[model samples]
Target: MSTLAIDKRTLRQDTWWLEPMLVVLGLGAFAVYSTWAALQNGNYYAAPYLSPFYSPCLAINCEHVSVPLFGSWYNWSPAILILWIPGGFRLTCYYYRKAYYRSFFWSPPACAVRDAASGYSGETRFPFILQNIHRYFFWASLPILAFLWWDAIIAFNFGGSFGIGLGTLVLIANAALLSLYSFSCHSCRHLCGGGLNSFKTAPGRYKAWGIITKLNEKHMQIAWTSLVWVGLTDVYVRLLAHGVIQDLRFI
Candidate 1:
């Protein structure tokens, strides 16, 4: 079995590097925006509307916060407490594993491309071994998704009055997008369909599995859409909270 002795890095003809490079820029920009927004602490709450980045505001300093579970002792942004669940989920996601591995790690940046590293250890190492807990992260994210939905519902309550506003719609859309991304996860598919030997035994599970499978097919698109929408939702709330913009009321 003699292979070609070509010494070049890759024989790919098309622009394979373009995809990974774009991924780098997209994820990098998101990291910058999310970091800045999370640390601001202020301008995350605007009355009936709260930024998705700081929902379930746990700190006493959080404005209009319902829970205040962390209390005043816990200073800094409350987003620090909440973001980690979703962050860990996305970090350990199967799709994201491929994305960052190619873009950030540059390990076989594209199809048929040479790996950046000389050797391969896979995810058996200390930090990479942690990826195995992705299913746990998925479980943890379920409650967070519930909270986001609660936030969207509360956005309709304006000081005890039912009102519809642009911010309310934004929060609703944000929650919906995140729901799509979360439910479309591979872990969710496994939970719905895995470990089943006979689909005839559990028709309900089979139906749910079919639905999740359809969603999973578009997981990448949903993931990116949800990520961008969350950032935008935060910006919308920040502007309104800072008095830079006023909420457009429809009802």
Candidate 2:
């Protein structure tokens, strides 16, 4: 009976569900706000009057802008939204596999409880199996970063005849967000660390890995910061496009 009590305590300690639940709820709220902001800016499709060149849409509210074909006419903002779905999942995703088995899918723990007189059965159930996805997502986000950079350049073109566009500021914000995302990724740290095989053997690779590990140690904070910044980047572009916000130009 005493051994069973100890086993239950261990199981409870390993399966934490609250943290991930909060993260999901928070991200959902942000998604709703971002969508509303995008619609308000006439960015649900495209506005050539707001941005002359590189407009994703040929006409406003046109059927030509299809989600399956081009994925919404608004350029950078939509990209940000798409990236965010996986981004949120990657954050605090380590517990997903564990929580799923212990709390919902599998219910009872996989290991058998035994007294000291008998041998203990090891835990056969897998924990953190879903976290393997983070590796793939880390690599996938890199190209998205490049696309965002390109969009930032186009966003700078101001619609009016004379004034320089506010796209540069938007570009800078996107760059910052990309930096945060790249730095905090788990797979990026492994890549920086010199892949799986040479991570410990190569001296130079080890040094790089150490640096990235240090950054990844603060992954939670960086994740939240990047998440908020990316959302703000979308809103900023939308506001500028809609003439709700003005970008100040020095030169």
Q: Tens digits of per-residue lDDT for model 1 on 1-251?
A: 35667767888799999999999999999999999999987888888888888877877888767587886788888899889989999999999999999999988799888999999888999899999999899899888888899999999999999999999999999999999999999988988976588889999999999999999999999999999999999889999988999999999
RMSD of each: 1.6, 8.2
Q: Which ten-residue region of model 2 has the weakest summed lDDT? A: 45-54
Off by over 4 Å in 1: 1-5
* Each prediction's whole-model lDDT (CA): 0.90, 0.51
Error of 1 at 145 (Å): 1.1
Q: Which regions of candidate 2 fall more than 4 Å away from where they truly are?
A: 1-25, 35-128, 153-167, 194-201
Q: What TM-score against the true fold does each predicted structure earn? A: 0.96, 0.56
Model 1 / residue 113 / CA error / Å: 0.7
Question: What TM value does model 2 have?
Answer: 0.56
lDDT tens digits, residue span 154-193, model 2: 4444454333434565456656666665766667777776
Question: What lDDT is obtained when candidate 1 is compared to the true structure?
Answer: 0.90
